[model samples]
Target chain A: MTPSHTAESARRSAGDPPPAELRSRLLGALEGLLAHRAFDAVSVIDIIRAAGVSKASFYFYFASKQAVLAELVRQAVRRGHEAADPWVSPDAAGPSDPVEGLRQGVTDGARLWRENAGVLKAIVESWGSDDGLRALWLDQMNSFTDAAVTRIEADPEALRHLGGVDVQATAAGLTWLGERLYYLAAAGVPPFDDQTVLIDTLTNAWTATLYGRRAADGRPAGGAIVDGHEGR
Target chain B: MTPSHTAESARRSAGDPPPAELRSRLLGALEGLLAHRAFDAVSVIDIIRAAGVSKASFYFYFASKQAVLAELVRQAVRRGHEAADPWVSPDAAGPSDPVEGLRQGVTDGARLWRENAGVLKAIVESWGSDDGLRALWLDQMNSFTDAAVTRIEADPEALRHLGGVDVQATAAGLTWLGERLYYLAAAGVPPFDDQTVLIDTLTNAWTATLYGRRAADGRPAGGAIVDGHEGR
Candidate 1:
């Protein structure tokens, strides 16, 4: 894996586009390195060595390690949107009780964080310092915020329940809330590190804030879910 | 301020300890630098030069720039606890409605973040890569989480309203939510950057999650606070 002259020989003979294959290898190597090392501690030299590519090839694909990190963050954000679709998508259908759909969505989102913890962690830790990374992060966050705002606004019941709370601000706050919780969960911080409890807590929060109070049976006033206790 | 030999003249002769003054100078220099540059960009040399202190004096007071950062974070967390007391303190007296106290606390917290934005930003950006900073950050977060849990558990009304939600985990999630929101506001991120909306949104989320549904008039079902519109 740590060879300098193996890039040409290691290429698969399966008619893979050479340039795309090399780029993928570099990306994969950086992602793999980030699993154990912080982005600051991981260098281009280390990435290429791990990718079994030459310095020239590594530069040909990426201007710097930060560039590769930006790409990883972009990919992760796209996957994050997909994972959140069950709850954030305005037309996505699910259980009659929307909170149950939310639970499922949050559950999937937590799993996504665990899988991409390395890449996400690097971006969260570095974005504040780098101009490009900061812009990219805020832009990605806005997408989630907009999706959440749209979903909530589309639900007249939820909208009526919100009262004086500004939808755009609340959506933005909730989006940041999810980001922080997922970051803490990925970093193995306590309470948040407990996945079951984390999901339950977030689902409850979302239900309460967006759907208003639940009845004694743990169902929203308008909800008729048969068994709230079954999932947890 | 940039003179190498000015540390001697910069000291206040008001019976302040020389060592303490020098340490404070170093800390202040680093904090000021952080406002303009990320921690990764601020070096020991930069700190000392800004402090107008010798390299040996810096090492004598603190082990590294990171050590100084740890101290700043500690100081900030202490101030944070004071700012949060109106809401998080179980025995703190307030308006007939507790949510008013929560609003005041959240507003103070936002101000605190704005004041310490530079130092707090540095910690958030570097903690993931530095083991000591990560531990310090997590420990400080746990203090907030514990206070939240204690406050929630003490309020039987709030407890009753929580339903199946786990208090400990909910407190942890809300604590991180506040941290993220404050960080974004301090960083001047949109939506959250609007202070009025930020405070109102957080107050609403806290009110709903901890106090359950508000009445049609915007007061929680359990209490009476006239004119919810007066503050906003």
Candidate 2:
């Protein structure tokens, strides 16, 4: 398995299988269950039955359904981090172009939302009432915020356009912006439900925020070469 | 009371008071309780006790706790509509600047969130699991998106800067962007929790989305006469 897929394996307990084993099965089962029913409606028996595991095996891994939720969130966040790697990488600053990096990252991020919409929706819904989930959610978002801040600060071109804007707050707000848009799209809310529109709108928002306005051709005015074409 | 304040009164049952009455009191009580506890933690008995009303009175006004939540969401949305009036007003197109209108509207929006954070948070958190709330929430959000679309389409100066951007999708994404940031600020999530930062970031994002890039003075380039100062 790729390193990103095995990243969750490090969290496994001493007795768990060496690879992503029963614990992953349990987590995957919960994710599958969320596709059709509300988290509150899904019980331990349902989860184990879906995974073809016993009640004892379920409890042996997750203390509760919420525990599985927390792990699913962690796993989702890891994948999110990997997807955004292009934006945060040093290579994004040079010939690679940060705006293009943003386009790639956002497209991948949208796909991530599409793939794990149910797990993400359930966890987000519960974060308000669950302290552990709330804290973990914020922490995961901050990682994205931090990555954005790093990218923005490192780019003089972007900074020149940002002017006196508060980088930290801007980054965090944009991070929350993406989270909310993705959530709305995943929930099949109108306007945002169209995946192509979601991706384009986000790319334009980020570009306009970082540069100034987009050119008539829909590229940021004077920042980067997009898909091998220079800005007008 | 102003027309905005009495907007919810029209929804009162025939038996309720002529003006803002016991139903409003129940909503106010629930809003108050949410400040200290999660919606799931606040029971009907707790709501009645907090409102100084009887169980019969509570059930007479609201079918269930979830019903109360739906009403609270409706009331909050009405107030939100009032808060965003400046952005959608025809005056926003002429002598009054749209960007400044945006500033005033965003400032009012952030304050609305601060005042109704707990209530709004509870409803938003529950929307995923509750079909009634999910529909109500979407309908409410669409109202804001409509306002944004109206404003964007009405302003030729703003359009000149927009180029080929999808007005409907762009406006919807920006609307969701503001909602998410305001929620984070109200929830006391970092960076966004700083009220000043939250308002500024939102204002900037809106300006950027509508006009391309903000100038060094933080006004949208070549668009509006912001606060009596023309863009350089």
Candidate 3:
């Protein structure tokens, strides 16, 4: 029924019917409700009244208020995933250093935060209380961490040069930093012009700090190579 | 007044009823509510019911749910400040050395987090939904940042070895890192076992990264100058 609720129609039974426009209107109204009032304060009565949809329609799409919140969290995460553009995976690379995978991960991570800040905020805001949403967050961030670790460990040459880098810890630390910075940037932290600057600064610092390497003269140097293969 | 509400009688009217017990109950109830539910989900009724206090008692202590949350944030901040053990202010010192100030700040910072993790989490969780809370977080975090900047600028001699440490940016960066790590540690981030470890690791890495030096390969290094004056 509504443009925003496109997926709702797809889930309806073959014989069942609700106009797409009404579905979209309901979704948009929910968004407006949440933006203006605390989610808990919003009632089903309030929702249907605002959407101009029947209570029957409300039940058709959602099981309960909690279900709506759950759906919101899911939509937020899905949007985050869609907005992402992490580093090219090591498996997909061609003659490139595997660590560039991490670099790409950092770049893509920053981009996702910038593009989907609202969605990200909704997810993180839910993290403290919503177990399912929290799990989703841990899964997504840990996946990135896992990918970084795999990239580091898979490259023998790169792993070899990491004499001091704690592969596991560093990966976890970077992922945590990215998640936190994502929130900060979404909240408009200064000196971070946009996600690009935030990503560059974080990746640069992370590369330098984790590797225990000094830049040539204090500025982040160009693509740092690991044993002349994977650039860390 | 619930027990917790009494803690802030100093901020309220002198003629206000001595609702000490009620204040405590309210604060304790708030703490429980925060632990169990998201900020937006926790309602005035929930807090009052949790405290086993009358609705009128709840209002007697707090103007609104937001008021309860605001007071909670303030109490948490005060607790954190009180938890700052051995944090010798630079002005409290015989002399000013930014490194010494920074070292103390780092140590104090870690100790504060280690001691008051729940408070830290409550404050952090409140940031996104509450503009006032976000401003408070930035101000509190930036105070630490400003301290680092002052120390860095004052103790220029201490940083002689660092050819180009970009004091201001480095201080801001380290402050951000410190606050970020505090949250991470509260959330059970591993490898950062205790306050000392976090303080030492973060302080060293911050200085090392800023000065283009390598972060040393050691833990638990809160050496002399914990007094802000070595060889005094």
Name the candidate that leads on TM-score. Answer: 1
**What would the per-residue lDDT of candidate 3 be over residues B28-93, giving only the tens digit for each residue?**
788777665556677888887787777887888877776776777677667766544224344554
Residues A36-136 of candidate 2 have per-residue lDDT tens digits of 88787899999987886778878888888888999998988898887778668767453365666677777788988888888888877788777888888
What ranking of all candidate models by lDDT puts the best one first? Answer: 1, 2, 3
Best by DockQ: 1
lDDT of each candidate versus the true structure: 0.78, 0.76, 0.59
Better-scoring candidate (lDDT), 1 or 3: 1
Per-residue accuracy of model 3 over A1-232 as CA lDDT, tens digit each: 4344443433445544555655556666676677656554578888788877788888888776556666655666566555342342445543354334445656666666655555565656656656665676777777667766765676665455444434665566556666766677776765453554465456555655554443233225655422211111
Pairs that collide in candidate 2 are: A212-B212, A212-B213, A213-B212, A213-B213
lDDT at A183 for candidate 3? Answer: 70
DockQ of 3: 0.18
Residue B99 in candidate 2, Cα distance off native in Å: 2.4
State candidate 3's TM-score: 0.66
Candidate 3: count of backbone clashes, pairs at least 3 residues apart or interchain:
22
The total of clashing pairs for model 1 equals: 0
Query: Fnat of the models, one by one?
Result: 0.66, 0.66, 0.15
Candidate 2 C-alpha RMSD relative to the actual structure: 8.3
Report the lDDT of model 2 for residue A2.
45
